[model samples]
Target: MKPLVSATFLTLASGSIGAQAAEIGATFEKPCPFGDCSAGIAFTFLGETSIQTGFSEADVEFGGISGLDFDQATGRFVALSDDRAERGPARVYELDVDLSAQGLQGVSVRRHISLLDVGDIPFAPQSVDPEALRLGPEGFYWTSEGGGSSQLPPSVRVSFPDGKHLREFALPDGFAPTAEGSSGIHDNLAFESLTMLPSGDVLVALEAALQQDGPKPGLMLGSPARMVQFDVLSGKPKAQYVYMISPVPQAGVDGEKAMNGLSEMLALEDGRILTVERSFAEGAGNTIKIFMVDLSNATDVSHISSLARHEDLIVPARKTEVLDLNGIGLRPDNIEAMAIGRAGDGTEILLLAADNNFSARQKSQFFAFEIVQRLQ
Candidate 1:
């Protein structure tokens, strides 16, 4: 898909700025309301440098990334960007990776899945790009930008490495869907960030905030950021968890604090799920929080919800500061993409990627950390 949006509304102070830089427009494989495109705004990668686009103030090629996935069986990395960096009928590329040598600078042999010919679904809007994706038991599963227009179920697809085939995967009921009317329907949707567990369970982040297309245009935004499980074959949503972004220390989160923004979510193999919460709404202290929630033990995420009577389950996530130690500023915008991997010695690495909003003011960097197992 092309970048989510060509322009972004930035909230800046001398020390920090909170807002999405530019978003990649959603596109399928061919030109149409739904097609593959290369118009991207930001990128996240799993290489030697781990989300290392760390430029705090630099102009970047927009429409650079749509989503990312890593193959555990082969250590191969695939970053889906708007194909050809254009605005329609985009293609998905598969990158062969070897992090053993390079960091974010790792080398990748690339392949493309052209989506210029998939027949459009009924009632879908024009220019919807494939914004986010996940690697499923079947293959790659993704969501588009159309859940805003017609309640079209988030689009799911499977991409096989053979390159001769790319198929569409259908979204079944209960898997959870996103609603529009928030700040913008451009990048945020019903199921923006998706992840699958080794146990066959799935977690999806519904950008339950407003679906309007601008910066903080709404006085208020709301939605239950949901996580659900589905049967591999039938594609039925089996379970769900709902939660919220913390209301700033002063917002007094006495009501339903909305979980409006998220760049990515990763399902830990140990049954815990981690997420990057990018709240642009007023009163939400926007940060790249890596939450460690035990979804295996809880069925409903209401426990994680901090309503007037509930206590939020999200703990104070230990974040890797790319500033001071790294010179990156405090507003690391959208730094929540994740990957579960192993370092050379076999210790598990929780790799988190941040979206720098591609503005001339933030860092286009990524980070990798060892999950201080035992959660001390």
Candidate 2:
């Protein structure tokens, strides 16, 4: 949900300062966590663009977009901010998207909705790290990376379109924050990605492996992240699947650390899901790839603990690389959100948004890709 703490390393003078700037809060980089890079499956790259806000009509305090969703019925885009309330209240903005064959035409904020709790109060600044979001039948479904000290198990909640909290879902006890009596998610690395299945189930992904599962991702190995399918309407979990994440592509550069994790996900027809794996290194910039995960033959691991030992017992989701952000030649930032924006003409257009960390050095980036190949 937040950048890893930069580890101390020998600073190389040969690297560019811009690269060092990107390493702010970055941890020490390790080699490819999963040994080597697997070739990604191909997709037609349509167009791409970088969004510049705080200018003209686009002058909106729109940064920290940790989640994204498109309301087809309203032809509007929802960008959820992780800004607890520092700059303003935790909010989601409705936007008008202008996309043509030429590329990303333009995007403008139309309105904003403030998220609230059961007490009818806005989230205090830094109190909650709202990560992933999805459009739901009754309202919006979202996840929050509750802070470390609070012992708040990562949570999923339903909120009205106007930002009223309707209810919260129960998380598996293994995801508890304390490690004394129960296994738990690593602080700050809890729920970061979510999607709504056609079956009306809400699939939530933990950003990293649970503390008891194994060590955090390393260059020579991969970390097993869990995706739980919850029956949203019923407010109960239906199943869980293992979704693995490779270590950061490049460790650290010029003494800066590189890290990677699942940022967002979308459900497709059939029992498949689309996930965004985002990695970042100081000087290397950001690396984002879309992976198609097949849950058809996947085993439910909801009841399984310590995935490391049950590797042979758990049938993890089958993942195929779909698209790599570098192929488009745009300098990628921290791209943490994604959604299907439009589908027509035998292709689907995906809208991707980057979180700026509210840093002057970083620009909130938006990218568009016309997926020429449709998922079967």
lDDT of each: 0.42, 0.71
Give a tens-digit lDDT track for model 2, residues 1-376.
Answer: 1111112223222111333222211111211112322211223334455556443223447778889998877777798988767777778888777665454666677778889977879787677678899999988899997654667678998999889989999887677777462468877778998998988889999887888776666656678898888987778888988888887777777768777888888886544677888887787788887777778778888778778677466778888665555643446788889987663332345778898887777777887654322222
Query: Highest TM-score among the candidates is held by which one?
Result: 2
Q: Can you give the TM-score per candidate against the true fold? A: 0.56, 0.82
Candidate 1 TM-score, true structure as reference? 0.56
Predicted candidate 1 versus true structure: per-residue lDDT over 1-376, tens digit per residue: 2221222223122123233331112111111101211211122212324223332112223223546676677565555543222332344445443333233333333555544325432212243445566776666665554444554455555554532235544443333234533322333455567777767755555554323212321235333445545555666555555444433222324543433355567664444555655554344434444444445344453233222234445322122211111111233444545565644434344455444443454433445433322211
Q: Which candidate comes out best when scored by lDDT?
A: 2
Q: What TM-score would candidate 2 get against the native?
A: 0.82
